[model samples]
Target: DSNNDLNDSEQEMVDIEYMGNNNDTDSLGEYDDTEVNVAGNESDDNDKLSETFDSLDEEQLLFDNGDNDTDDDEFMDDWTTDVIQSDCEIVCEQNMILVVLKKCRGLISMIKRSTILTLYFDAQRKRFKKALNLCYDVKSRWNSTYCMVNSFIVLREIIENLFSNKHQLHITQQQVKKLTNFELTSADWHVLLVLFSILKPFYLVTTAMSGRQYPSIGLAYYLLARLRNFLQQHNKKESLLEKRLKQLLLKKFLNYFDDENEQMELIMLHAYFDPAGFAALTEIERRSVEQTIKKSVADQASHSSISVANTLSITTTTANSENKPNANRNVKRNAMNLFNEFVGDIQYGENRENESKRAAIINEFYQYRKYVIEFNEKHEPDAGSVIVFWRTYGETFSILKGIAKKMLSTPATSVPSESCFSTSSALARKERARLSGEHPCSSVFLKDKIKL
Candidate 1:
């Protein structure tokens, strides 16, 4: 009775969900096989269906009347497509205007100039729920170039769809031929992904070095080593191009930084003060850095005339006590105890001997190295920790701390200065050209130092 009571429209109408996958694309607008059961005191027969069909007219059974259920779905699909394409067209026009407002060239300029192609690509993004625009590479920034290449990789699918639906997007035959050459194939994607992977470390290192909030000297030295390690490691399945790239990059880096004693001394000095950087050094490198530091200490100590060993030692002449207890017949001391006291007196005499400046500096360096090793082992260190470590150990290693203070304060990049220039340019525009120098300085201090 449940099935028998159902009308023709109720039995025929079924909901269709567009999954937007390759498999469902073939059956874009088709009905599903729906089943209904008859469970009444009625005949379990074709007689019920036959009677119901005979009574129903073509007007009600065809489902093309005003009460059609598919109407809403079909209308929604049409309106969505139209509205999105319309919005895409507007976005494309605005981006094209930017291309005109600023000077642009190369592949980006070509893509932006092709209004039809941009419109189609934008439509694919909206349809796929990706709300991003294509980025343009700037001349002065490698990061921007990296971003441009990366964006294309992310939107590769949308670009492929646009090329696939050339006729649907009203692309002319001539444009299609031109676009076929620009289309990314499997080989192209492989090449781009490899190139992007190769550049990823450089981007990260550049970003890290350019930050102004923390010390970058130690970070620069450490990251440089990590980068070298990265380049040295090889994948078993590398292509010829990847091999060639690795070779080229390694050679380029080695040309400037490899095996040069003087250059390494400066870099190692910075790394020495940093706990993690010191840990990263090979034994041979650590020994070399220590030897260099010892020479500096010897020179600085030679001029001061203060004996470091004297300052460290507590000298005492072993004077025999006249108030020593007289040996009693009742309390005879053991011979082993008498021998130990004799040995202690000999060590006391040795402790009174003065140390040479050279020997004292060596002993100081060893103590510093021991502290560095223990401290590094106890706590994991980063760039910001280097300054704090030096500050905390200032009294312990006064000379080395002074050297580190002078050296590590130097920034690896001029980004801070460049940022100041940009901010100044923004602040002293035509409208505020009459401001005094102190006003700008105060404003910058307030902006950087004050939260409110």
Candidate 2:
């Protein structure tokens, strides 16, 4: 009876969920099989779908709700229907903007147009002497895209007026026909300018991050933090588009940073250990980094102890001593007791180590800061010279020197590797194609050693 009651209650709940509070007998009837039948034969389903599609009219196919207040005539004029002569091309209207820009790419290739623009600029050199020259973007260099867009924006007025002299510019009849629908307007230029401004900082950031001479690892967290802050600041910008772009960029950066932070604990340790970078971190952050380093040291010491114990046990067996079993057991017990003592010693040593490390960190930090004050330092210490300082004065601050050496030895970016690849590519060019096989390695070594 209990099970039956439970079943009835479940059935009533299911009915309530699906049927709601319906009072009509027709609504209470079983649901029709008119809904898509996934279990039906594939061919029959396809036929039914095709029939349904055939029944759809132009009105039914369109999704326009007639709420848009944009002037249809002005929109039609802006986006020419030369490519597809249809009034129903509004679905891909957003994409049509990019399509127009892509078509305008050919305008950059016309020699006559280029010559005229150069001549015009030369004639008006007094007023627009600093005007940027027209340039095309290279596929291999993304920075060139910004340069291209910026140049276009700088010469927007001249370009717009250039259309009046289209015939004198020697634009052929076919070229004119092709470029008819691809003309950029004042509003388009404004949008391009906004985009270029948004991307300007990224170009600068890329150049900064690619620095080969500096200890970029120490600057990594600082640079990324600044970029995050910059993006957040832009999130408060007036333009909704700019704000949305910044939000997306910030989200992506946060996700990347969260992932990299886990992998760069050692890098942060090295950063904290850097005297030049010492001032950049707060006291709390410095303490956290010191604790992380201490934990890593403890882990290494533990592993080493375990390996040493195993080696000693193996050596004892190999010696084949003629000691009695009780004596052997006693030795074993003594060894076990010694191990326990060693563990206790490690625990006690850690407390002392913590105190000593804390003192050392504070002393180095203050000493460096004081030295900078005495010298009236303008810039931080030379990043490239850090390793040299460690090598020369390593005896004075042995622990810090070791840390500096480790940090300096590690390349902060894959730029060196990329530079090598670029060198190899240069060596393998059409004229020097066979040179790569001869002495590419030697060439790279020489190239790296030569101080420009």
Candidate 3:
């Protein structure tokens, strides 16, 4: 919510009259007497913050507030985001949010605490006519940090003016007292740009896997592989500080991918059936998954062949087919074939018949393997899901399809279940607090369900 105080544009660059004015600094003197209007933080003060700002003219604030940078020693008269991004692409690109937060935090707090600052920026947004506000980091989400750092790079001019030397002169001495030591340096700005570039891939991966509208598992392994490659490729080119951060990040990533060994698989067994994910597998990994499906199919066939009906069917079908069609031809089966049929346990078979059934199952997997290999070679990267792929091809390889039905339905992440819990939590949080336990329980339980 504190994130709403953001504006980006140069279109109409209007003037906003300083609050109660002759001087912009004139309003800073009276801010303590007014309620703070920053991102939901309220103050019990003489008047509402908006009423004070709403009365001002926009065109005057643009020049009266610290926005005028013609004589500012730290920044150019006309610095743009293009130059900032070029610097962002080159500097020590670790997470710069922490640095900027540490360095300018006091000044930032000072700015946010002043309703006068909001009044000036709000008037600016109206003049420029832009929809998106600058991004402020939300601690609970990883991507929000990227958004915050990017906001810094994109809105450097605004930020520079807010902490510029003249900015301190224009504000009350009490507010500017501690902010003198926290101004942003050019190097700090570069770090911000570079950090934003580094976080781009992470932001993309988080967004790609965050789909609630679709099964995102199909892209799971594919995105992971690409993200891994990005870090490793950039690790070599990064500055010392960045290289260390990349290594630490890479290590943490591997922990997520290869975390469990004995019970759960990190490669996502479901991924092998996903067309996008299948393409990410190495030849060895492809064989490993293929072999696993083949084994399942073979095991299923082995058990089925041992059943009474299947044995009888196999015996009548494969044993000297010439004998089945009596009019066509009658040829006696070889003595070896006859002896092999009854060998070991006659009921359970332990015979060539059951082995042949399993062999047929394995043969089915081989055919599936061939089709899949060729399929991936020609597969478009962005289209199709595992469910659709198996659904379309399952009929041709019925045995393999059975295994795929169970394997491919596996969720790539816990987002689906988390979504359910999140809703319950939201419901409980809204009205159940400080109520009877059973009352809350019934309310939570029936939040979305019909009583009937």
**Considering every candidate listed, which one attains the maximal TM-score?**
3
> Candidate 3 at 249: error in angstroms?
1.7
**Could you tell me the TM-score of candidate 3?**
0.59
- The runs of at least 3 residues in candidate 1 whose Cα sits more than 4 Å from the true structure, single-residue gaps closed, are 1-107, 138-142, 237-240, 259-261, 301-360, 378-381, 420-452
lDDT of 2 by residue, 1-452 (tens): 54344323322211111121223223322222112233455465345434434432311212121112112211122333323334453334335435534534544433212222233333332233333455555433446667667766766665665555444332235445534544676666655766677668777766665766555466555555557677889534357656665675576667656457666565566566444555556677777886775565556656665676668767876666544455565554568787876774344544565567667756755554454343325445445534544444457664555555666555567885678788778866854555656566655566677798
Please state the error at residue 193 of candidate 1 in Å: 1.4
lDDT per residue (tens digit) for residues 233-352 in model 3: 664556665565666667767665655453224354566767778778888877777677666656665677567666676787788684667764556778887787767335544457
The best candidate in terms of lDDT: 1
lDDT values for all models: 0.57, 0.50, 0.56
On a 0 to 1 TM-score scale, where does candidate 1 land against the true structure? 0.56
Q: Estimate the lDDT of model 2.
A: 0.50
lDDT of 1: 0.57
Error of 3 at 403 (Å): 2.3
- From the highest lDDT down, the ranking of the candidates is 1, 3, 2
Error of 2 at 205 (Å): 1.8
